[model samples]
Target chain A: MMNCKEATQLLSEKLDRPLDTKEKVMLGVHTAMCSSCKQFGRQMEDIRSLAKQYSKGKQTEEKK
Target chain B: MIEANPSLSASEAPNAALFYDQEFMESLRSQMVKFATLQVQDAQLAEDAVQEAMLSAYQNIDKFGRQAALKTWVFSILKNKLIDLLRKEKRTTVASQLENGPNLQGDALMDHLFKENGHWQKSERPQKWDDPDHGVENEHFWRVFDACLTALPEKYGRFFMMREFLEMATPEICHNEDISVSSLNVTLYRARLRLRECLEDNWYQAKESGS
Candidate 1:
């Protein structure tokens, strides 16, 4: 069983590279059972989009 | 006024007029300065880089037709200028700092979040962030996001931005920074963890409490 710490590290790693089958399976099982890891994964996705908006200078422009 | 005149070469006219627009130039300058300042961590050095970039961009305005957005071209120039400055000032504190590996403070923070058994400390587990998509549109929310990014230790912030903002690939970043793949992975992981906690504490929880 993967602990939350390892699960979280895999979560972050998947952003930068594709996970092998074993790693993906472990992450899927852990996150399915762990709401905290699940939420952490979702928030990481949110942060990626926020970072995109930030790169596009969305905050500096007025709301149109 | 130039748009009204068709006598000038059609290919070259519009962008030149845009390059000369006072409002567009001012806004672009401010954005460039902000980005440079964040990367270089020095106001005066950022200003110098932005000024040089803007000047070269203006001089090369003729080459800017239909190739890329003016803002994109200008930012590329600024990025190059910043790299040059960083390389030239090799022995300076900022350069030396970049060469330094992640600090002990970062390790302590990680230990605080994770227990000896590699489980999240109960109190440190991530919580739900409600309606995060909507939060992206909120101006105040972006301010909080910016603050969280700025709060990251300098090298971590730079690496995070290089990956996220600059959209550089992992291997490319490792090549540019001369770090091993595993170290880059660890740095990015720690950066994301800290950024997540910062946002949760400062924004999501505050919003939940209606504070």
Candidate 2:
């Protein structure tokens, strides 16, 4: 089994939907228990959400 | 959304709209522009790169092979155009490293990846959820979220733009960049790791400020 860091590393791959069943379950279980990994997952989402916003904002600016 | 074509004149090739749908092209406009921006590092030039690449694809739509997705093919052309622009402008351009500022200079290995002033300039944490029972929207959350992204590493910044903003798939990304799948995955992992750390640090700070 991978440690917290290793599992955290795979979190992006999981986010990308490239992980297999066992890997997915392992990361899910790990993030469930690991505080840092949980934080990481949230940040991954935060960055993405913001990036989308920035793109949209820029799009709007261009329209104006 | 591109409507699939239901009819074509006999002997007329299904190449033009097949290679790219007009409405889909409109949706992909900003995405291509964003991808070119990160690659070329200049907004105007990036726009030019995207325009040139799109035109080139349109002209040679019939030559596009099925080996790559149309998006990937367009991105490849944009990448080539960016490289060409970089070469032409190399003699005049300054070598300023791209950054979001709060410049932290250190010889330490780990410290090189972060800034000294810390993530968010403003410490308000936004509301993650909206409730009809409770009062309105959570605007603060968006502010903190934007700050976290501005704090990640530059390489990760472009990678994030290419994948999330441009909407390219992992397999296509690997093929376009000519990088191994594992390397691309590792790059994404590190990018996510940095972003995760930045978000956690700010979320706690926001709580501190709110309290």
Candidate 3:
């Protein structure tokens, strides 16, 4: 089982690209057991989504 | 607001509805200039690049197939211009060294939060910033977010913009940066870690304290 440290690292990496099967399984198991890492994963997703929107400013909204 | 300003597009091209409208173009220019300034870190140079981008975009408006939003297409043009600017600056500035050198401080900061056993210290565990609408709806939240991003190391901030804002693929980033994929990942990981910590301190925690 990957530790929280390794699991968190994978969580960030998975944002940039797809994890391999082994990495996905390990992260899945680790996050399943670790609430902190799970929260970290969610936050990372939020940051990614928010950053994308924020970086583009309100252009997307104006277009709509 | 733009739709209400019908005079802005009354005498413009048929594609004026697609962003050629004067008022819309003015707003887009300012936004593009702001975005470019963040990436370039120089207001004057950012404005110049935005100008070039706007000219190119206008000249090639017919080439636009409407397959993508006008803003996306225009931003892509601006991004290409910014990349060109960065490439030029890379030769004359310290950007090459910053990109190639070890980010020792980023590593030390991360290590300070975790232990030898690869676990977060009780004091350092990530906290929930549970406001779901903070990033989406609140304009003030973005000001704080921008401050946190500005606090990052310059190279890291630039890299983050390339990957996230410009929507460049990792492989393309690696090739353009002349770094290995693993190296790029490490840089990006450290950038996120630092931004997360900074935002937690300046935005989330501050909000909690105020409330």
Candidate 4:
């Protein structure tokens, strides 16, 4: 079974692109069983969303 | 004297209508310098880029034709200038930067966080962060975030920004940097790990205690 460290690494890779079928199932299983990795997934999502808003904030400043 | 329309709110004013005038370019000057400084990491170079961008924009003012937001048009010019500066730096400082090239030495830090079996070390497991929405509302949080980004090794920092802020694709980044796709992925992953840890320690943990 993939451990937390490996699973979290895959989570970051997923951020860059879509995971293949086998990697997807394995990450799904690891995250489903592990609350910590699940939380880490949410955090990556938060960071990416924050990046969008961060740049948008700069654009808003550009307007003035 | 013409009377202003008191009924129309300030927010109702259109930015596009102002693009052709010098007034809008003047307003963007400081903000452009601020953004360029973050990207290029030097106050003098950033100012040069901003000045060059603005001057070029003014010279080509007629070509603007109000087709885009003045801000977007001017910022793209600034981006080009910054890239030109980077290429210049690349040519002149190849020897010094050879040591600073994209590297995977971040593995030492990762090994410390994870054991041989790949489980997270007890001391290194990620803690639950503070409420993210409220966290973003705090100006101090962004200050810390910027500090964390600046702390990253220069190459990793630029690569991360190219991917995150500039939103470049993996292949595009690899081709531009002349690195393998796998190496780029590893570098990006390590960059995220370091950044996340830094932000958690400096911002989120501090928030947990303050509240």
Candidate 5:
């Protein structure tokens, strides 16, 4: 069973591109089984999408 | 005689004019100047940092990497320059900065992520981001996003801006900062979480009014 640490690392890198077959299988199986890991994966994906907005030509700055 | 009210606003805004013009340069200057002041808390020093970033950008216009848009490119330059300025300030003068490193936040790394009884923990888990029901055409989203960015501590906020806003790859970012790839990944994760949380608040408020 993949731990949260390993799963999250692979998830983060996957945002830029596809993972290897072995990694994909491991990550796929891990996320599918662990609800928390699934939630964490979803959040990481969401972060990538939202992060893309900052790359867009935003008319005004978003203050944090 | 031609002076107009600050509230009057421009009649027909020329967005493209921001590309290259004295006025546009001034706008960039002011933005960097203000952000720098906030982080370093030194007007003269901040001005110097802003000046360097602005001038360097102006000089290297042709080299502007198209990977990130213009605003992002400029911000990245300013961010790097600001870090240099802080390091310089810390090393030579500012005896106090030398002693305490001008850092108030204790264990900023631990504050960001730490283990308690061997369990990893963070301060707050941000809400998830969705491809909005109405989709990307939403007009006012950036305002909410920027607000969240402003609330972040300067160091984290700046790092987040470089990665997300500037489209800097994680490996490149880590190399630039001499940080590990995992460290950069976690930093980006936290930055996005905070932004998502803040944007969700705005979306909820909008929904309450309509529903």
Candidate 6:
């Protein structure tokens, strides 16, 4: 079984590139059993989206 | 030279008058400087790059009609300036050297977060982040976000910005920085882990406690 460290590393890499079949399978098995890893995966996705919004200058304030 | 896109009708394009608005210009300059500073990691150099990009934009503003959003056009120019500065400054070697520094030890933070068995440290496991989408919309949340990003180690922050903010592809970044794919992956992975941990501690937990 892939451990949380490996699982989380794969999750981060998923943001930069597509996972291979073997990696996808290992990550699937790991995250399926690990709630913490599952949550970590979700948060990674959230960070990516937040970073995108940030780059586009999305902000609520009218001034700095 | 900026060229007008014939495909864009007059109404579809952003109002050119916004270029002359003081508030708009101030906001644009701030955003540009913030981005450039993060990438170049030098305030004086960042300012110079932004000023040069803005000057070029101003000189060619007449030709900028309908080609792209004004902000996008300006940023493209700034991106070029940043690339030039980065090349001249030779930041890539510094980043790679830091990656190999004795203290790096293949990432001390990774060891702190993960146990010998590769499981999350009991106290270090990720907690539920409440309402992250809503958090992104909040101004205070952005402040926390910026603080977290800025707090990252300089090497990690620069590569993270190159990939995330500048939207450079992974291979492109590896080639430009002269690092291997695995090394870049490790850097980005560490960055995301640290950033998430920082936000959760400083922002979400604070909000939960305050409200």
Report the TM-score for the A-chain of model 4. 0.85
lDDT by residue (B135-160, candidate 6, tens digit) is: 77677898899898877876788788
Question: Once superposed on the true structure, which residue ranges of model 3 sit more than 4 Å away at CA?
Answer: A59-64, B1-48, B54-77, B83-96, B99-104
Cα lDDT of model 3 by residue, A1-64, tens digit: 6887788878888988899999998899888888888888888988898787765654444453
> Which DockQ-derived CAPRI band holds candidate 2?
incorrect
For residues B1-211, write the lDDT of model 3, one tens digit per residue.
Answer: 3443456452354454655457878888888987898677689999999888876766566666553367767787898888887666642333446643334335586687778788887776888886646444555776788787766776787778888877778887776666778877877887888788777777777788988
Candidate 2 chain A worst ten-residue window by lDDT: A55-64
Worst 10 residues of 6 chain B by lDDT: B1-10
Best by lDDT: 6
TM-score of 2: 0.49
* Model 6 regions more than 4 Å off: A59-64, B1-47, B56-77, B83-94, B98-106
- The digit string of per-residue lDDT tens for model 1 on B1-211 reads 3334444453555566665568987898898888887666779999999988987776676776653356767787887787666555532333226634444336687798999998889999998888776687677887899788877876777778878877778886666566778888888888899899989988999898985
Model 4 CA deviation exceeding 4 Å by range:
A58-64, B1-48, B54-77, B80-105
> Lowest summed lDDT over 10 consecutive residues: which window, candidate 3 chain B?
B91-100
Q: Give chain B TM-scores in order.
A: 0.64, 0.45, 0.63, 0.62, 0.49, 0.68
TM-score for the second chain in candidate 3? 0.63
Against the correct fold, how does model 1 do in TM-score?
Answer: 0.72
Superpose all Cα atoms of candidate 2 onto the true structure and report the RMSD in Å to 1 decimal: 11.7
Better of 1 and 5 by lDDT: 1
Residue B58, candidate 6: C-alpha displacement in angstroms: 4.7
The most accurate candidate by TM-score is 6
The residue pairs that clash in candidate 6, if any, are none
Cα lDDT over the full model 3: 0.74
CA RMSD of each candidate after superposition: 6.3, 11.7, 6.5, 8.0, 8.7, 6.5
lDDT of 2 by residue, B1-211 (tens): 1223334321254445543455777766777786567655778888888888877865666676542256657766776676567446642222124433342211231234322332211222222422211111234554565566556556566656567756567776665555567766766776665555455556544455666
Interface DockQ of each model: 0.50, 0.17, 0.44, 0.37, 0.23, 0.49
